[model samples]
Target: MISDTLIPDTSMTETNTDKDHIKATMKDAILKAAEKVFSDYGFEGASFRAISELCGAKRALILYHFKSKDALWKAVAEDVKTRFLTQFSAYYHEAELKTDLQKSRQLNVAFLKAARDVPEYGRIILHEGLTPNERIKWMSQELKPELVTMPDLQDPFLIEASLSGLIRHMQAGALLYLGSMGPLIAMDTEDADTLLSDASIEQFADYFQAITLARMDQLKQLEEMQKEQVEE
Candidate 1:
């Protein structure tokens, strides 16, 4: 009988104040604080009190939204997924057909452009992927079912693995771009093409393109061999 009423018994005069449409100010405040703190210190060095102080919230309020430091870290990981993975996955998937080494130059450039445009993306990836953490593992397993399972539908795990490695290599250079070559690259500028035109930025992108193309050729050979076996 208790299970029959899933809806709250609020009267008609009572307004529903806790709708999902309501912006979670508390959560956002805490998340923003956590991002700054975590970015500066990494997860191990970042403290709840530091985040709470940065957020201008009591420690209890921070804990109330996040439950525990681990939960907060998980939230940050999810934040990275929402911020970076959603867009990068789409762009990378769309850029797949532009596999020519020349055309992929633009994709490589675009990757750098996106990192600049979305600065948090660089920090989040470095922290979550490059660094080791259970929170990273948990969020990765929870969030990336589509990316991981995609190899099943695509039937080319090798291609995807090679691509993953290439992307990681590009992202590894992102911080350096921000620190040293940022002004010349004009990373703060909005133009993608201009920033990519710098001659010094050539090596990683060129190497990635070459390696990826070679991997593709290998995959094609494997496919042809499988077809021959089937015909035989």
Candidate 2:
């Protein structure tokens, strides 16, 4: 019969808990570093070595956490999706939006904040839009069904296109090509940096919401005019 108190159950539990905490920390660090690298260099351009360098972790450790680059990309995409949904859900419930347009604006605001909070999300999306694959399809499958059910998001395609296109273009102009376009836009390095600041993102979100609502109102007016003509 072995002595059960040799190491003590409490000691064993503490050791296991420490290991679990370390593993979780390392995994989180790797995911964060991978997001920055993937955003800078799309899926094809990103490398495990680059991510390891960024996180100051060994390549073997990263591989241990995530089997391969594809697996890592999938993980990051899932994280982005989760963050967006979580933020939107929280804001929707907390805000208690009354009308469809109000809900739309609130959701849009939540999305912009999520994109800003997760810097890699927009870059990853732009990359997917340029070179779509099964991953993109998977993302669409995950998001589209939920999006279509929203009262203000019934026409998911049009809303997605309009919002994504705006974000992509703004990201490219403000972040990706800032070095080149900064001078032309009369923006110094500091000014360019401000483009991605929280205040700027909020401003952009408000502008986007206003334009979207205005467009919807215009469409409604046009439809009513067409109905009048038909009745006449």
Candidate 3:
């Protein structure tokens, strides 16, 4: 038989643990829903009610978990950055490649895959790029310290902005421009959804890879010519 003091302590501990689990679960749900809503609608357009509804939780619960929409958006951005870095790390460890160029290609492929897997990330990033809000500034500042350690992301800003822009344009261009640019790619307005399809993304990735390789080769040749001129 346990002492009376021991019983209350054990019960309190169990209750606290359960509350923590519930809070974490609710936070995860809120973040998942927030990602979709924030991606579809920019920060100003996103609503706490809509996020709560999507997550099937009360607005009060969302408020309890995240204080405000600004806090929620920041949390979402941090979560995305964490996941992106994790995916990059995993891919870097698994890829056994020969040259820096080859590794760069692999890194791009990994980035594309990660973007496709979490397309919201691209949308959020593009929206931030356009809006230039405090949240965006905060995220950029937070990532700056770690940028030097990421060799694969040598030009992190350019690489990320390029990839995110490509993904966002492919996914949301129709809404922005009434599909005016679709004809250029032989794609009709009705086929906009296909842009996010796995087959289409793979094809696009291949095309991008070829173009990048060609550009790299051209740069190498130009450098060789410059070296020859210097020697002469």
Candidate 4:
């Protein structure tokens, strides 16, 4: 007995679209607020109430988007990962990377920009590093594998010089240098708000890439000599 006019109209579709857009916007805001909170206080010290206040959203809304604190933390981690990979590919081709050393250097450069772009990712890592927990385990599984590295090799004397996992260690340095900028906002720095300005990023990248390449070359030579002695 229903009339044909009873069917859904464009008005209803438009309303639904508007609601979806609002939901996405609210969620993104919550995530942005959470990134700052978690980066500052870390997972243990971070809370929904703080994120809610920071985002100006109700606590209930944050809960609706992320069921628990753990869920929210994991979501943030995933978001950071997506942002990094997205930025890394924004310019060049990954396939174009030739040597493992070159790939590692490029990755460090990429991380420099990625961390500078968001900065929260680097801060989160430093904070998380201070405390080992289930989160780190999850990261090792979900996040660490996203990047490539050289072969499995190490020498105690050449740990900092070796290409094997060089990206990992350099990232630690990068995190300290790049991640600590948020706190440095209070201390007067050049004209810009942070050292992550476009020109500064390029200059720092050039310096890091050059030094890292030299150290890796030295370590490679030492490794070759060790191999020669073993053969003799």
Best by TM-score: 4
Which tens-of-lDDT digit does each residue in 124-159 have in candidate 2?
A: 766765775777787567644344224354554336
Q: Rank the candidates by TM-score, best first.
A: 4, 2, 3, 1
Instruction: Give lDDT: candidate 2, residue 215.
Output: 64
Q: Which stretches of candidate 4 lie over 4 Å from their true place?
A: 1-21, 92-104, 148-163, 181-194, 227-232
- Note the Cα lDDT for every prediction shown: 0.58, 0.63, 0.60, 0.68
In the predicted model 1, the residue pairs found to clash are: none
Relative to the unseen true structure, what is the Cα RMSD of model 4? 8.3
lDDT-based ranking, best first?
Answer: 4, 2, 3, 1
Give each model's clash number: 0, 0, 0, 0
lDDT (tens digit, per residue) of candidate 3 on 48-127: 88886677767887888889888898888778767766765665557787764555555555555555555556667666
What is the lDDT for 91 in model 1? 50
Question: Which run of 10 residues does model 4 get worst, by summed lDDT?
Answer: 1-10
State model 2's lDDT: 0.63
10 residues in a row with least lDDT, candidate 1: 1-10
Best by lDDT: 4
Q: What residue pairs clash in candidate 3, if any at all?
A: none
